[model samples]
Target: MLRTVAVPLLDPTASFELGVLCEVFGIDRTEQGVPAFDYRVCGEHPGRPVRTTSGYAVVADHGFDVLADADLIALPASTNHADHPPQLLEALRAAFDRGAWVMSVCSGAFVLGAAGLLDGRRCTTHWRLTDELAAAYPQAVVEPDVLYVEDGRVLTSAGTAAGIDAALHLVRRELGSGVAATIARRMVVPPQRDGGQRQYVETPVPRCDADTLQPVLAWAVERLHEDLGVERLAREAVLSQRTFARRFRAETGTTPHSWVTGQRVLLARRLLEDTDLSVDEVARRSGLGTAAMLRHHFAAVVGTTPVGYRRTFRQTA
Candidate 1:
């Protein structure tokens, strides 16, 4: 249902975020059985060099006209968000009004807010700027904790790697998780990940050491089907429950329960996609206990029940 993609270049673009869009949507992966987007990079002036905030410049082959035929329009972080080129904003508004999928990475959400597209939509940006986005666009519900938010065809993601998550999510939604997973594998990232900006904001990932909790995390990952409650995990880590909790908050940025639930949801998605497992079987395999419990968690975490999810992805193949 989606194919064409256009990324519009604004002045002083953040190179990494712009690069993220290009890597996700611009690359040709049809040889690998993935749908290749008709991708275009556009600027206000065709062939004019746009300077990046990182001290380099790049050029766009097309002008704003390229956006007209696009199924998706991606915005990257720009040097300026409060005031945008009128023509660019108008084009963005037209794309949104016509029901095209429009997404922004990092500070690029500011451009959507300025265009009035974010008004009354559930959106997000980098955690550091969520308050600014909310203050600037009072009509928008700015959720600061999540990696991304989808309200209709408009999507906004947080900083850096979070853009990958948001883009892969869209790909999975439109083209199925198989295609998304393929792209993710090629990119060497996960198709879907749990937790969010909350953990990162509270505590960044610490430098690894012998006493680091990564070994414990790896151990827990392999045993998601087992009882990994705090008590057991803490004892396995050879620390008091209180100390383990504190260190976990420091290292991973989320509680043990929230982290494990996310892992289970991911496993359920994998089972739904790659196995012909029934709801009860998937529930048991994913360690969620029952079909009813799996449905509740899967729907809450994945926005679809297990059966519906399986139906969507399985039918795609």
Candidate 2:
């Protein structure tokens, strides 16, 4: 249903953010069975070159007229977060009034705030600019920690690469996980990343003897069906439980328990998407121990129940 995607550009745009939108929505992947979106780059004035933060200028082939019928309108980051064009703001308001999806990357949330779309909605931008965004739009519920937040038809993401996560989430929500996976496979990125993950780590890394935990982590992932408590993992890593805890936090930016739980949830997602296994079986195989436990953790991490997730994302022959 998300067919047409229009991007409205402002001057001094962040090229990487703009490229993220283009990569996710504009690329043609029909050969891989991913439906191509009707992507357009538009501006207030058609055919006029807009300067980018990287000292390059790009021109929009269309104007705001393209946004009138767009299923999705994405705004990319720009250095000039304040003072969006009045016409662009009006177009955004009209699009939202008609129930079209509106998304912003990084500081582009400023444009949405100016159009009154972010008021009273949970949203997020880059962590560095979260305070400024909250102060500027007091009525908006700003979540400074999330990678992205989706409220109603509006979606806002944290800086840079988080745009890919938000965009892929929308694709999966609308088109199905199969289609999203196809696109992600072609892009060589993970098919799905939970939007609730923290955008940045504020705590300093603890000192550890090891440089990385890749081998131990990889070993744990393969044995997710087995008990993966901190004590067991610490034994495998040949370290004291206290040292393993500190080193795990330093190496992975999360506790051993949290990381293992996240991996199990990911395994559960794969099983739900690629198999017709019963929810109880998925729980058992993913080391969740019981259906109730799976449901509880699945809901907490995925925002959906196992049955609901399978119904939504299950691949069919």
Candidate 3:
């Protein structure tokens, strides 16, 4: 259903983030069976160069007229400032009001906020700027620890490469997984990433050894059906319990419990996709201990229940 793709640029825009939108939709890749979009790079001033944040200039061939008819309107990163063009905000509000998919990359969420489109919507921006965005737009529900958040037709993504995740998610939701996978295969990127933006957020932790954990992690992965408590894992690694917990959290950017539970969820996802396993049996096989535990973890981490996931993604292979 997505046909026309329009990028609305602002002053002091980031080249790389804008480039991401162009790369995803600007090309003609029908030879690979991926549908091509009628892509337009537009700005308030047509045929004139706009200043970039990096002391560079980019010329957009189209003007604001392109956005009026777009199936998807994207806002790439710009200066994290509140001074957005008034007409740009109007265009954005109009796009959203009529049911077009509107997405923002990184600091671009500010632009959406300026447009009043993000008010009372669950949205996200770059983790670094989420607090600023929330403070500025108190009405918006800003999720600081998510890679992206979609409330209705509005999609907001985290910093840098996470735009690929948000865009591909839309493609998957609208066009099906096969098309999304085909596009990802051509792009040489993963079709999706697990976990939350918290995994990449800057935070302090005690220094820890990294070299020795590979074998331990591999061993634990193999025996996920068995108990993987910190005490048991520490005994297996021949370390004190407290030391093991700190080191594991430092290395994995998550607690031992969270990491092990995430691993079980992944294993359960594979079983759901590849085998005809019942919920209880899959939970038992994946070391989740029970179907209730599996359901809780699966829904929290993967955004779907076990049977729902299987029904959506079960493959013939």
What is candidate 2's lDDT per residue for 1-317, written digit by digit as tens?
A: 89999999899789999999999999988888888899999988889999999999999999999999999999999989788989899889999999999999999999999999999999999988889999999999998778889999999999988899899989999999999898888888888764343313332322335656777888888899999999999999899999989989877788888788888888888898898889899999999999999998987777667887676578885
Give the higher-lDDT candidate: 1 or 2. Answer: 2
| Residue lDDT tens for model 3, 135-190 | 99999999977778899999999997899899889989988898889878878888
| Model 3 misplacement above 4 A | 206-317
Q: How much is the lDDT of residue 7 in candidate 1?
A: 93
Ranking by lDDT: 2, 1, 3
Better structure of 1 and 3 per TM-score? 3
Error of 2 at 39 (Å): 0.8
TM-score for all predictions?
0.65, 0.65, 0.66
Candidate 2 Cα outliers beyond 4 Å, as residue runs? 194-199, 202-317
Highest-lDDT candidate: 2
Q: List the residue pairs that clash in candidate 3.
A: none
- At residue 261, candidate 3 shows an lDDT of 83
Stronger candidate by lDDT (2 vs 3): 2
